[model samples]
Target: MVRLPTVVIIGAGNLAYHLALNIHQSQVKLLQVYNRSRRGLSKIKKNTGVETSSSLNKLNRGADIYIIAVSDDAIRETASAITHLISKDAIIAHTSGSVSIDVLNNLRAELCYGAFYPLQSFKKERDIDLRKVPIFLSSHQPKTLKQLSVVAREISDKVVIIPDEERSKLHIPAVYVNNFVNHMYTIASDYCTKENLQIDHLYPLMKETLERIFDNNKPQDMQTGPAIRGDKATIRNHKKLLKDHPDQLPLYHYLTKAITRYYDENN
Candidate 1:
């Protein structure tokens, strides 16, 4: 972006942590990091060897790009506060999947606003493998789009230019595949504990399920097990077992109905 543009990140959470590391390693010149807390600022400063400040007013002046990797709810507020501190020509961006690019439209510099969304789960303690993850980029201005794309491609080999509307849809599927699936795992873990069963028993199935779909083709095409076999007895027993847990009952029935419907049509 702008031939190794000087960048500043305004957040100290998981997304910010990994993004700063990726940017620094790519020789993109991270000018500084901003956080309201001393502890968060210290962590980012220590990890990246980059300048950090707890005060937004003390931020480094005249950066080429300002990456606001803050929380979704605080995006607009933070952007508004920081916009006054940076140069008018400085391009501002946020790393959010769900927030539209127009969230920053009210800024004095509309042409310098954009979105840089990384499609993957992030944890504060865990280091993200940025090389494999795909980064989606969109900007209101064509020149800003080109600049952000160059910056994104430096840290990720799989960078795609997605339209704002399409990117919003992508976020929903991402929640289903990543966030919802992880919650399902947590539920399974609780079930395993209650039944004196090991969660390890499902590890192979879980891993293989993902590999098969990605390595092969559609999941509907690779259908198998009791549902595909039309084992009504097993299905009935599952619903019966889930009756005591009313919360899970609906999910069980919905998935079963979906599978049964698929088999009914495909067969």
Candidate 2:
């Protein structure tokens, strides 16, 4: 980070793919990219114009920073694989939200290890503005954390040094907001399809739901539903509508009951 860091991204999956593009756009020296196979490497090389390789043994040594952007489960193995290639003091890190930075340290005790997690789900086909994405960084060593902050600031204005415990806790709400919420969208889409309705009809509602968050509206305060209104007839109707669709019935009942509990307490 202090030296206008050079990067060698070690993975060709979605996170690595987008990271390469954004890092390339950041104007950092992306020295090389490596994957275990040639499958996704070609598209990355073609897109970012960075050299790509499939051999870990052939990974260029002495880069300022090596980004281990591989999958979470593969982190330990990947870090072990590159231990021999990097210098004793080389900076190496991963982009996993669930995995700890110590996983890298455990593999290569001589080198420096850190976390370079972007707190957003990445899709290769979809472009993201990294400037708006909050980047959480952590390292066992303060020096490494400082260096990571420097690199993170170069790519994103929103950077923070979050410890592993806090980072893990932070990912919980991320799941509620992103993963679980997306599943709710899936259910809504399926229900629409079952009812012979176009899912496009829900897009505006979806947009407004997100916009309300940015407008600083608390979801509880904005709540509007039969449960909140204590309209038993309307809630029973919704339950009846979904009863035939066994899979969605339970979810509908659960959410209604949960919302009702909130108002029940207030009353």
Candidate 3:
């Protein structure tokens, strides 16, 4: 039988919450979780039955891996605080897409440091099957990379070793597709609510749009509506309708012109 590495997680936010649950379910032994506040540790401890701590000084020292799943801003500070607590031979990694592995570079002389970024949007309320989520791992040391890969594979089926420069580039497109696109949906839903229109009616259309993209269809090739078709009258009418919504008008106009210009140059 293969020995799975012991794991310790830091943070109890959305990504951390989901990661803790997945690790608890996997073959890896999740020894404990650490959060800055006591309240944040309650749900994870209750569900996973793993030991929890509000202080970094109380983190489990025996775990083979320590995953710092805190916010991008706090990753460095969190790592620095736990530097003296964990075993020197243990592997420490951060769960961030945009933040580089260098955030933990300060600890390289004494310990193995790397990144364990999960390229998926996490929401604590929503339970997602992480087996399909792509996990990106990176480490300066070959031995550390191998160890990180083993832990990543146990939690996710799709694991890739993406270095810092390349991984940072991927984050740009990720934000556009996930975060920016979600904001567009939020704006549309708000508009529907204000107009007394049932947003649920658009569910099928929204589902189909995503399905088409995932089905090996290019987004630009699948483009429809007045913007791509160059229907000037319809675009004018949409702008007019959005006149009351001053904030939304600029976005509509800008997207329309962008789509129009893009197709004109390409086609």
Candidate 4:
């Protein structure tokens, strides 16, 4: 039988919110929540009937694990404040994809410190069905890894052990897929507004783009559009229109040129 560890969560943002709810439904016992915001405290308290406080000293004692789910910048600072409160043997983990496991290294948690990154975008208003998301987990100690795996498995069916180095690599592509893609959408929205075109018209293509990837393993192989086909006339026409939108023109030209160069060099 897998032994479920007693856990405390140390944040109140979207990740922390859904994590607390997910852990509550698992075999692990949720001890308490610690956060700096009154609203964050009240939010989790309302959801799980769990005790919450802004003071680090007030953090629940005797817990087997602590998940620090604060923003990336505040993670180390928050971990510093609560290291003394937790049991020396208690596992300390964070849920960041970009930040490394070494951020918690200075606290001297050693074998007790690691990462529990969930590779999915979070929105507070949306309900999280963890079973559908991939969880990239890592730990410094073998026992700690086992304990965390059980907790993670209960929440996500797609849980996998990812080394810190590989997790870092995965984060690079993640930024392109989530952040950079969203910026592209914002640009498209701006262009639509200027052209008096309905942004809603792009919804089907946007949805299809995502659906294609979910149904395949390699997205680059599924690439489409004029640049891929070397349609010079269409490219020239697009660049002509781009002359009026200097900012977007540069970005569009840069991306299209890079893609064209890549195709020429490889294909």
Candidate 5:
């Protein structure tokens, strides 16, 4: 593998956009950017000043690494389609926490392959301190793992060689913290709109909640809520308030019951 491998990024979505930006920012050669559609191609080209292509056929086969930053459903399809397009020695990686390295290799039986999962949510417009984000690396071959890990370390200090078994475990907590928590935020914002309340009013609560999580023990050990406190009256009152919002009520009740049950076992 080249010291700083040349890269071809596939897809033009959030992950691709940010990955392209970071890869270039780290002074790695971002040779090409490809997307299935031209919709957001111009924006990425403008920001990175790198050549972009909407067609996979236009990709440079000589690039040292190909990072498929596409969606989970498209990982296999894109890998399979691009297998013959690149150098057989080129390392192909996907930035999916849930997808296995075997899937990438299976899709392209002979080529070197790996997973280059950056375990963080990305928004293209906002700058991320990539070093702070954990980039999980996995590969069937040690040379492939070393190459991918070298590429990963360029953008993140927290690179770890995680096997599929442990990588899948990491994805679970990632969903709990980022995806599921973000959904709760979405629900909160909608709730605020319906109740004539500003969602920003919850910022302090959110801030302190995060502070405790970071400052204290495990989330379960740091757990504090009416459910865990066994404050039945408060829980009842909260449920009554959500009664009119039937959609949110179910999750609230279910989570409350779950929290209560967890504490019940402890007590």
Candidate 6:
């Protein structure tokens, strides 16, 4: 029988919670989960039936891999604290898209370190099928990269070997697509609430927007609406409608101008 890698997860945020559950369900042996507080640990422990630790010193040193699935700011500090506690042969990795792997490598020169970033926004309350999510792996060492790939493949089918520089660059568009787009939805929902309109009415349009992109249609080619059509009259009317929402007016103006400028320059 082939032996699966033993794992230890640090931090119990959204990503950590999901990773723990996925790893537990996988062939990997999840030894323990550690968080500074007990807030999120209980849920992870109860679901995964894995040991939980609040202290870094109490981490399982025998685990083959230690994944620091914490916030971007806390990754370095968390890795630094567990530098001496982890096994020398253990592979240390962080689950961050923007952060470089040097954050872990600089702390533990002897142990192999890399990144196991899942390019998906996680919410602890919602369950996600990680097999569909793309996981990006990076490491300076060839052997370490291979090892990380083995673990990554167990949880996700789409595993890509993306270096730090390229991964950081990808994060920019990721934020634009996910975060910025979600903020737009929030604004639109707020507008609907103010007007006493059903936000659900816009769901079909929103769904079609995503469907076009997934169908290999170019966003620029699919661009429609008053801004792209250069309909100044409709634009003026839309601006007038936003008179009651002073804060939202600037964003609406900026986006309209941006869209207009892009199409104009291309045409």
Top-lDDT structure, candidate number:
6
What does candidate 3 score on TM?
0.96
lDDT of 1 at 267: 78
Give the C-alpha miss distance for residue 254 in model 1, angstroms. 2.1
TM-score for candidate 1, residues paired by index = 0.92
For each candidate in turn, the TM-score is: 0.92, 0.93, 0.96, 0.92, 0.94, 0.97
Scored by lDDT, model 5 comes in at 0.87
Q: Write the per-residue lDDT of candidate 1 for residues 70-154, one digit (tens) a residue.
A: 8899999988888887788888899999999899997783549899999999987888889899999988688888878878888
Residue-wise lDDT of candidate 6 within 1-267, one digit each (tens)? 756678899999999999999999999889999999887999999998999999766778888888999999998898888878877888889999999988776686677999999999899999999999999998988988888888899999999999788998899999999999999999999999998999999999999999999999999999999999889999999999999999899999999999999998999
Off by over 4 Å in 3: none
Best by TM-score: 6
Could you tell me which 10 consecutive residues in candidate 3 have the lowest summed lDDT? 102-111
Clashes of each: 0, 0, 0, 0, 0, 0
Lowest lDDT sum, 10 consecutive residues, model 4, at 105-114
lDDT of 2 by residue, 5-24 (tens): 78889999998998888888
| Pairs of residues at least 3 apart in sequence or in different chains that clash in candidate 3 | none
The 0-to-1 C-alpha lDDT of every candidate, in the order given, reads 0.86, 0.86, 0.89, 0.86, 0.87, 0.91
Q: Note each model's CA RMSD in angstroms.
A: 2.0, 1.8, 1.3, 1.9, 1.7, 1.2
Q: Model 1, poorest ten-residue lDDT window?
A: 36-45
| Count of backbone collisions within predicted model 4 | 0
**Per-residue lDDT over 1-267 for candidate 4, one digit per residue giving the tens place of the 0 to 100 score:** 756788899889999998988888877789888888776778788889988888866788788888999999999998888888778888888999978888888686354888999898887788989888899887667777787787788889998888888898899999999999999999999999998999999999999999998997478787889888988899899999988788898897888888889888987
Off by over 4 Å in 6: none
lDDT of 3 by residue, 38-146 (tens): 8668999888998999976677889888999988999989888888877789988998888889889876466799899899999989989999999999888898888
